[model samples]
Target: MNRFATLFSASALSTIAFGADSYAAMPHPGTEPEQQLETTITRLSPSAYNVVLIESLRDDHSEPPFANVTPQSHEARLVQASVIANPALSRKLQAQNVELDNIVGAETAADGSVTFYLR
Candidate 1:
């Protein structure tokens, strides 16, 4: 009966080691920024600030380019272009052309900033 005892111990240990606690410790499936972007796109108004896109793309960049202003119509043009080009944002931004090679982000001009990804 030692074999049965060993099997039982092994099974118990395995269950505890690879159980609910481990799963709970894991991050939620899609709470990441990328996924959130998709959802937020549907809600973006025509005038979202481009700075938001810059923040999204340059997430790992040491210092993002523009962080000063709010969203505007002029900036919105560039933001739309960036969204159209970015693969990550392509599907959601497909209302316009999708440029797979394009880098998505924001830019600044005299008046304000525009974000391609909806705010």
Candidate 2:
């Protein structure tokens, strides 16, 4: 029937729209950045940098600040906190000697790395 055809079309479009995205659907991404001590921050320009948080860091449940965020967003926020609290990113900042403060955005890779853009 026409309704069935409409449903099939909608389903196909939905699949195509979402199928291309590679981020994992992590329902119970445990913990915050506590155990995740490793992170990388690379300067993209004078005022911007990128932070990379390895997959293991994102394998835990979300914390308070990041509690309501989706898994991908959770990773981004987690990395920011992890690096600041964990020391390596702070060291990188000290070495680079720049004050980076704002979190612009974040992206997840299928290969287990989440990169955050900061300004």
Q: Give the candidate number with the greatest TM-score.
A: 1
In the range 1-119, model 2's lDDT, one tens digit per residue, is 99999999999998887875634443336432333323323322222334533333456675323323443465445545654663554566556653434443344444445455444
lDDT of 2 at 56: 31
Report the Cα lDDT for residue 7, model 1: 100
lDDT, candidate 1, residue 36? 43
Residue 70 of model 2: what lDDT? 47
TM-scores for every candidate against the unseen true structure: 0.31, 0.29
- Model 2 ranges with Cα > 4 A deviation: 1-79
Task: Supply the global lDDT for candidate 2.
Answer: 0.47
Where does candidate 1 have its weakest 10-residue lDDT segment?
98-107
Question: How much is 61 displaced in model 1, in angstroms?
Answer: 13
Q: In angstroms, give how far residue 112 of model 2 lies from its true place.
A: 2.7
